[model samples]
Target: MPDTGRSERGAVSAARTRDFARFRHEALLLKALGISKPLIACMAQRAAVTGTSIETEVLASGAIDEEAYYGGLARMAGLPFVAEIPDGMINDGPALDCQLKEPTLVRLHCNGRAPVIALVPKITHIEGLASRVKRSACLGETIVITTPSAIRRAVWKAGGERRGRVAVHGLFQATQPLSARTVVTGDQGFSAGLLISGLLMLLALAPQLLMIILHLILSLFHLGGLMLRLAVLAHTRRHGSEHETMLQSADMALPIYSVMVAIYREAAVVPQLIAALDEIDWPRSRLDIKLVCEADDLETLAAIAKVRPGPHFEVVEVPAMQPRTKPKALTYALAGARGEFITIYDAEDRPHPQQLREAYHRFRLSSDKLACLQSPLVIANGGESWLSAVFALEYAALFRRLLPALGFYRMPLPLGGTSNHFRTAALTGCGG
Candidate 1:
């Protein structure tokens, strides 16, 4: 209460100083390994941008003093310094079980090259290392090595030959270059209008264009049908008092609700899923949340058990079946559900607190024909990369704009994979 704002600013400044010092120390260690200053600068910038700390420890055989290297890096980067060498280094015996426990931004500099690995979580297992390396490849990071055995193994695994004499350090490189062709195309409204106008002009000029005109008219009629459906949906949403009354009646009945989450090999995402469910604003007593897992997925089962959720949290083991996909698993879970209403959420989804309430309101207001109310599903980590950004934008356009427009017109919804709230009776009747 006493100047809290000033204290917060001071804390932030101290954190930044610590970050700068860490970067400098790591850079000096890399220099001792024969990594260039320019490369170190690039790595430092990458690390700074990603908000990750750098650490380097010398092996027992190495002559380089860890403290001196750390200090040199800090001095070069123009930041405050601190260093502590752990008992183990990368070359330590039998690769000790070091956990990369935090979501880290790693900038690797070997020789004169720099590579960046973003949003890498603390890895606990040796098996996870290969997957991490593969993911880094997907992100287009350069791999460089100052150590001979490390480079040899990496090169061999990568199917690259060691050129010339056996050197202590070597570099592997890749980058995700920005491509103009990869950008999503904008709306083609003008071109479509021009095409329609030209067709009309042609029909006006040709008196014997009756057959072509008839075909065009038929096409227009089909389009009009689609438009009419949209119009009906819009009208229903805006003016259907009867619909609202029906939903209200349903709410008055106060039926129980169940939420199903269909998962495959999603052990990594289960923690987040449970966390999201825990944050749901609905009454916990009435909430029956199911974690539908495949029979063979031991990892997911283990992860679920680790959480040790309450009775409301049910772990449903799906039998091995053909077409082992989410929809199939959900179909199986739906058969056993005892709730009046059912909803689906994905492993990575972070649904809004009031989502269930909004869906209930929609149901209570509408007739049975409005069996499903699909809440918009958005990418929570959309800005992580260009691919994710585009994926997020596409979803936003579909769920927020296009789907609503379609619903307004009473057209059949293409049905998104998640956030679909359903009346159990209506869904069962429709063979859902």
Candidate 2:
């Protein structure tokens, strides 16, 4: 039998053909919108370098707003453009979640007139859609056009209740122990109380002995911790450079890397945040960047929408549930993640461009046991103050020395919150 581990040459050729078609369609779109040839050429080169689509480069380059560009297509196709789709007109459910990932079409149900499909009409299919409308006059009743954002908004409204419930309680329902729904388990609380009471009694009855015993226990605990950190640091220093070259370039078929940022009351951080994220060296088409915001954080949400991000960017709204924490927001949007690898970043984080590629390469080389990789977190503005200097040094020691050391010893690594790369399976298997 032939090998099934990889695509055959014919399959590869067909995929390349599709890429050409995508580029051609995007070129048509650019030309119709009066985009200059020089800019188009520049975008094409950037797309080639990144292994992304021309549309992606154009969108990321900020040459034009996403809605305005789509509106240009609507005008060219002779279809009406809708800035927003009313909630009641569109039926939505969890099944329609695919639309959320790659928003293309939505069926609208009106009161009096015939039902119309609101599509983010592709330039490649403009003629095809128009021909069908021509053949069946009633079909042309209204194949109205809308932006991806509008389609996303309508879908979010349609599946609010179900999606919100899943976001809030899906992990708990799947695996209660893995969830922090109940911060302290009943058994743990009882044990803690018993220990506290015993400690108090000992302290009161035999102060000198209790002090000596407690001091030894505390000292050993810390000593062990320090020894472990130091051991890991030394081990890493020995073999860290062995695979550095191998991790420079990732595999040809790069999996989608989901980058999720949980934003709350950081409206002012949006511009720089987006800019920093865009600096990541990855194909925009295969990147699923979710700017997850709480439902009540309208300011940040509005700021994100105002930017008019490309199709690759999604604005995931987490329900304002109890324990409105960053973890909760991230977990809420986990259901919509469409990547094989997932990573989280803070609004202020500016990760190195090759960080994803480096992590991905290491993951592929390592066995299945290698589930996660933490990118080093460095503070660039450490010279600002004494507090900043200490923070920077702490980060350098923890991320650069301790984390690698722990990994070298094959011990559990406490992942650095930002710039962490993880296998999607590992993440979801542990209840997301």
Candidate 3:
């Protein structure tokens, strides 16, 4: 009996040795498959010390990309390798619940009425999730392998997008009271009222003196404003003909451009707007084009939908708020902008094709304090009427002459409402 017990102990020790040997063999295989020695060692140590699988350790550490690791596992396991799940294939079913736990790594779907769970290989926790889906979904579950991005996209489609839209995110509040703060200041109206009241009282007390004082004040105000304008105009004329820096092709890789277009009652101009956006010389993938629309503007929304812009284009629906103005609409869209640089475009305006590129090059060349650039605005309808011609000349004077002079002299540059390019950080720093 004692000899029998000894033999049993020996058998148990041998089994333990074989298990350790298999662990070492797998680690060696991973190294042989071109995984770095340090990564293989980490995987082995994690497997032995923390009870984590080798594959899980490598994937979690990002030593190897998901595709290579999972594709290898799928081949070894004789399962299909799926890079991306088709859109609209996974509904909010029990299988979707399985994906929610590790949305970035796992996705569940149905393949020809057969439930399939796609996962990054060697994720120890996903087995139980798969089992739960198999029992509830009723269809036999098959396992496949896919990239991390694919799984994340599937999870986002399952419910994440709706959650993102409804999350409030404080965008509106960040740029709130935009009407009071941006366009028309509250203090301006109050000051105007006080001035008018004081003038009326002065006129009632002494009509001749009041008239003389009013005339003097009006003359000084108009003269000062005119002098300031003239100075800027003179400076602009001096520098107007100087050659702008040529935008190089290599410089294009540096910036992600944000284009914001605020549209209201311009449903008829959506096509033109789209065409103008398409004509921009910047890369489409790097462009963050935001089509800002009012919540109630269904016609514009329908028009945008019909245009069907690429993935980079997003239609931001501004919630109805007080002081509905163009600046307010832009503030609403500014909250969701994702780019290093930002610009505003009006609905009917078609900017020059090289404008964005030129702006980017200028920003790169200028000092850090140079926060904004005003692109020259020209009237396309100048020949249509005398009024249009006059309007064109006015715009040319303001944008081409006055604004550049203001910028050169370090004076406050008033924005031209459109075709204004700004650094995103600088704009947001000034309250979006």
Candidate 4:
């Protein structure tokens, strides 16, 4: 009997040694797998040293409590212990009576050396439990838990609270009205009232009459200009080679010409303008293309920035204080002009390639009194819509028929808005 007892004790000692050996091996594996040291330690406490058995419990509310078992396995296998809590656990309360009654589970998802706990409680008492847990855990270090729906509700409540706080602080109120008295003489008051009434009447009637008069004047001017340009073209054809020779000789003396494009809220048409400019036959290096833009216009700024307008392309941000008009912007840009000749193109302009060359030649041959040469603006997209069709016809009569006639007669030419090339010095002389 004595011998048998001694033999049993020896066997038990060997078994203990084997269990320790297995545990050490498992711990080494967990370290190699990047499992956090703290989590591994917690798992080792709950699990059997040798990893022979795993304990699992399904709580009363149908949540599986495999923390102890999985934690241990993770330690042994060197893997993270992740728990996927059911959605219902957060939505529904826990069972009425259980060992861990009203228990809240905190689950966290994380990277690095920290353990994350996301909590799902199965009972009403656990409703506000996460906030308390978060506060306490935050005091130690930090713990992030998933509570999306709860967080959303909290944010909404916070917004309402802020609104209520603002409501309490009412708007400022003036204590008293400002006082001033009018010292009106009888004649002055009567005269003032009569003047105001007259002004109102004029405002009502004057615009229509003014518009009619302006239209009549514009029509007459346009007709006269057109007729003159045509006559000039005819005369030039008859006069011939002398003028052509004079122009070719002048090109050698003049500096490269520059084109100025003024844009404001014109993002839609800018790309088309760029495409047209690119298609022009002029040497790119010789063309100084200035794209003038208002400083405040973001859309146009962004669109223009994306275009890699090679060496000759320059973006000039015009100050807002300048007159808020296309002509004003052009005038401002002209102040910095370096070319011997300059031309203006609107955001939608598509000038003929030969237009610049033609203008340059004309200026070279003509007298300095020909300060400005107005080029005909042909509407390319004329028949696309009713508005366009009318515009096309109007332009055809103005450019093709009338302007040339006006030039021939040497009459004062009211310039077309765009594609009007001028001798740079002449334009600068005309109020820049």
Q: What are the per-model C-alpha RMSD values against the true structure?
A: 23.5, 5.6, 16.0, 29.8
lDDT of 1 by residue, 1-432 (tens): 599999999998887687668676556656654656775565555444334323211221123343454344333333333232111122321111111111122233334545332222211121354454555654324321122222222222222112110110111111112222233333456677777887778777874685677789999999997786576556556755232232223222444578999989999988888988887755444566888887789999999989766545767666665557676677655544657799999888888876776688787667877788888888878989999999999888677666777677577778887899999988766445
Model 3 per-residue lDDT tens digits across residues 201-288: 9888988999899899999999998999887767766666557667865532545688999999899999999988988876444567
What global local distance difference test value does model 1 have? 0.57
Colliding residue pairs in candidate 2? 232-405
Off by over 4 Å in 4: 1-254, 385-387
Candidate 3: what lDDT? Answer: 0.70
Go through the candidates in order and give each one's C-alpha lDDT. Answer: 0.57, 0.80, 0.70, 0.55
Off by over 4 Å in 1: 1-253
Top TM-score: which candidate number?
A: 2
Clashes of 3: 0
Model 3 TM-score is 0.59
Higher-ranked by lDDT: 2 or 4: 2
Candidate 3 vs candidate 4: which has greater TM-score? 3
Candidate 4 per-residue lDDT over residues 329-378, each given as its tens digit? 66555544546789888888888866777787788667887777777778
Best-first order by lDDT: 2, 3, 1, 4
